[model samples]
Target: MSDLDLGVIGNCAVAALVDRDARVVWYCLPRFDGDPVFHALLGAPKDAPDDGVFAIELEDHVHSEQHYIENTAVLVTELHGRQGSLRITDFAPRFVWRDRLFYPQALVRRLTPISGSPRIKIRLRPRFEYGSVAPARTYGSHHIRYVGPQTTMRLTTDATIDFIRDETFFNLSAPLDLFLGPDETLQLGVKETADRLEERTLVYWRTWTHRLATPFEWQDAVIRAAITLKLCTYEPTGAIVAALTTSIPESPGTQRNWDYRFCWLRDAYFVVRALNRLAAVRKMENYFRWLMNIVASLHENDIQPVYGIGLENKLIEREIPDLPGYRGMGPVRVGNQAYEHLQYDNYGNVILGVAQMFLDRRLLSPPNRADFQHLEALGRRALKFYDQPDAGMWEYRTRASVHTTSSLMCWAAADRLARIALHIGETQRASEWRASADRIREVILERSWSKKRQAFVDSFEGEYLDAGVLLMTEVDFIDPRDPRMVSTVKQLEKVLGRGPHMMRYEAADDFGAPGTAFNTCSFWRIDALARMGRVEEAREYFSELLKLRNRLGMMSEDVDTKSGEMWGNYPQTYSLVGIVNCAVRLSRPWEAII
Candidate 1:
């Protein structure tokens, strides 16, 4: 049985998920939101013939191992057979070329013989409409064009055309380069183009990693996590996807699957905060631009929690019936209905994302008075909805409550705006925002705390606990050492904690009780513990949580704490954010080593 030990390769334009066996299992072409071109991860049973998978498998396969080149997004998988072994190098070409960045929405696989004579088989099955339609193929001298109903792709390769087309076995004698990209003939031959791309992409990733101001501890883990996060960014639009592939269930058959391919304003705060801490400005700057566009496009009371990467407003949910889901589960979903739901927490997030522009002098073009006026409009919305019932951060489908987390963030928006106003020398506006923040603070303290429970609950006048409340100290809604915060952590640990992993909440959700621990919640636990002066305990728990990452140092959205298997969407941005933030918070100061 395979674990969720998968490797991801992308060029900030597109991404793919490859298993240990070197199969391109899950990929969306042209862009992250485009229809699936390779959709094997949401499968039609492993033994079924022509299951719409893309694999370069060895006929004499024995075993295989997968890993990344150090500090890079490039992935290498070594497959050993009874007779011979082969190495596959997988990446999407992304680098600076001719004074411009060249990042094509393409996947390149280079197969080389390691030892002995290796017999290999090539299977390229590109699907359309979320694996509901198989593409018709037309072949030429050195290329194969796969034409689907809505999309077309071309495969340019150096391998024998007959062998690839027929899926026949061939003995490997030399290198074979396969470039699967948008429907265009390769100007240069496959081998030469692939060689140049491999060299440049390697340099691009290394140079990009070289600029990171990593912590003194866990440098490798941080770098890998940072790269994964970068790959999730859709550079053309500057929107970072929550994850790559979608509907990989939170756990087996729980129906907790969600499409995370779009951009969520709520996630932007944490994503930009993590990148900003590392002094990586490019992602932040790009994301700010994306946000500004969304802000500029917003009408009164029309802001949404989520948007298409292109800022499209509608996302209607539907299932791909032809594709049996990940791990043989059914109902693989396409669009996410959460876009239509009310998630008031987004208003605060929008303000927080822009607040950095006003405060950070490093920004090339910081926010002006006009920018603050737009942001204050969002702040006004947060002020209106902060006390109302709506969907909380978890995006519960069937429930509504005056969620303390949402209210706290409303406070954060007003509080941060006050400081931002001060930075821009607007004393009167600063005072007004400060008054609004204080009013929110008073409301939270009066209504959200449970005198009987001796802790801050998940909602006003409710008795349940949520892992999100652990974020109280994080957003500065409450001091780390405050009695209420400390008590909330204690009570939360007893109720929501499952061993070291923390569930988002124990309350029954749309899918009933959660079957897996949301990985980022545990990271919040680690951060809270660290700030509470429980240094040794925090270090131990943090180390234990790091052990749960997949072999590639990547994490999904959740993990089955009992079986220690990762689930949810692959290479989750929130999970990686937790790693970078925790490492930065817990690592020893540079002065200790210097």
Candidate 2:
């Protein structure tokens, strides 16, 4: 393997392998939610001719393989060729420094040749505002100033980086350095005589991993997944993006492209549950604090399904006319329009997650009583519009149906509100919320279940089997062993399970076409199996899903089982969380069926 044929996708961000060389051929810097600064995964250089911003051409390349560190966020790509074998480690340091948050701003690509000397290429392209604004570069011996609107990136290199027109590219045989200034001045340095960057990277990763308090047997994998999850989390706002890049079609050349880098309230409960399972209290605390801020800032009726990093509620969707999409998929987009769509299920998800946080005895400090009260007020207001049709979890194109998932979430909200009232000693409020929750549950059970199908339907009157119903087990709305649950799982397996991977639903009905199998849904099935006392089946399915992880132990949003190509966004947080959660569940002895 002389060529670096690697790719990474997560939180809607997609990156491609340039070659065996350590250089990142494709990457959108600053944030995954941001537009592309480097986009080569979509197609050849011709499609995005004018939009071509940053391109690195490496020298003395060899063999390379990408892998995540044992239990941390660091990504390592080992390269070996005619000159020597060098290890390049990439990571965004986590520990807070001087009251300034140090996240994934600086792309730390560490290179150490094991044997003979090998030259490498380095390129720097700082295109602000999604390659729309080209910055003027002023070069110094060790510094390069990239001036853009409201942001400046001071690129500092240990080895001289040759400045190209609107880009920077360099070839080096020794240590190299670079810096990326997003909002503030950033410094990067490499020295002949200095502490090992690898050692420091290991120290940073191991120290962080040790903070996890869970003693689960699958701690290694779980810790790695947790670290990935943390890396995906936007530290400033406590929002975890769905994936790093967008526009990677679920089916090649299909119209299933979606931007997932925004914060989704529907992911709230799952994120909290996974973090709590790992005993990661600090993360949950930060997330809840962010949630509180969102609730406090918005009026009850103005709540959106998602928000931008700065807590901006409006995400007007638009296409970047310049750049072509990944693998020729057209219409590359940013700023999710779905935020404007009514996603009623988010209310339930938020309430459920907050309630879970309250239930956890590990809450470092008691939540503010006022915050809880405000949350309750929001829930009550949302209930007024709960009967209205809105986009469901899939965020479909046509008018929203009576989505079973959304309705279930409504029940979840009411149930959690009742729990919240009980927690804070509000007996009267507790009784009222409890009654409301019971009513909602009754309505769901009566209206959502299809007698003809013998299982819960996707909506009030539809007979389709949606994989989302598996969440019923996760939410505790239905016992895993309930006959309905069994029937639902069986129906999904027959209808949607393609080998080990599962589809969201029968796709022929809406969205024009179905997509490649969704990796998250497959893990959900594994979880459903485990919860239903099918431990053996769960383990089998879980093992198969684990095999789908790329050579780097990372998973994408979907997989083409036929070609074994990982499609959609790379390094999807939901799939990783599902894997970790399911693994944890399966690691335990088979408890009595739920």
Candidate number of the best TM-score = 1
Please give the lDDT score at residue 430 for candidate 1.
96
| Residue 398 error, candidate 2, Å | 1.4
- Give lDDT per model, in order: 0.87, 0.68
- Candidate 2 ranges beyond 4 A from true positions: 1-21, 25-30, 42-60, 98-101, 132-134, 162-173, 182-201, 213-217, 507-510, 589-594
Model 2, 1-594: lDDT tens per residue? Answer: 111134342221222233334445455555666545555554323433434333333345545676777765556667766766566655544444467543445544555555666555555554556556767777776667778775566655565545433344333355553433344443334442123444554676677678876434556667767776766677666776776666667777776777777777776557767877777766777778778888888674656788875677888887766556775676777778788887788888777767766666767765867877877876786566556677788887567788888888888888888888898798999999999888888888888889898889788878888899898988889889989889989989998888888988875645564768888899899999988989898888888888776555567788876665788765677887886788778885334322
Candidate 2 residue 381 Cα shift, in angstroms, is: 3.5
Q: In terms of TM-score, how similar is model 2 to the real structure?
A: 0.89
Give each prediction's root-mean-square deviation over alpha carbons: 1.4, 4.1
lDDT of 1: 0.87
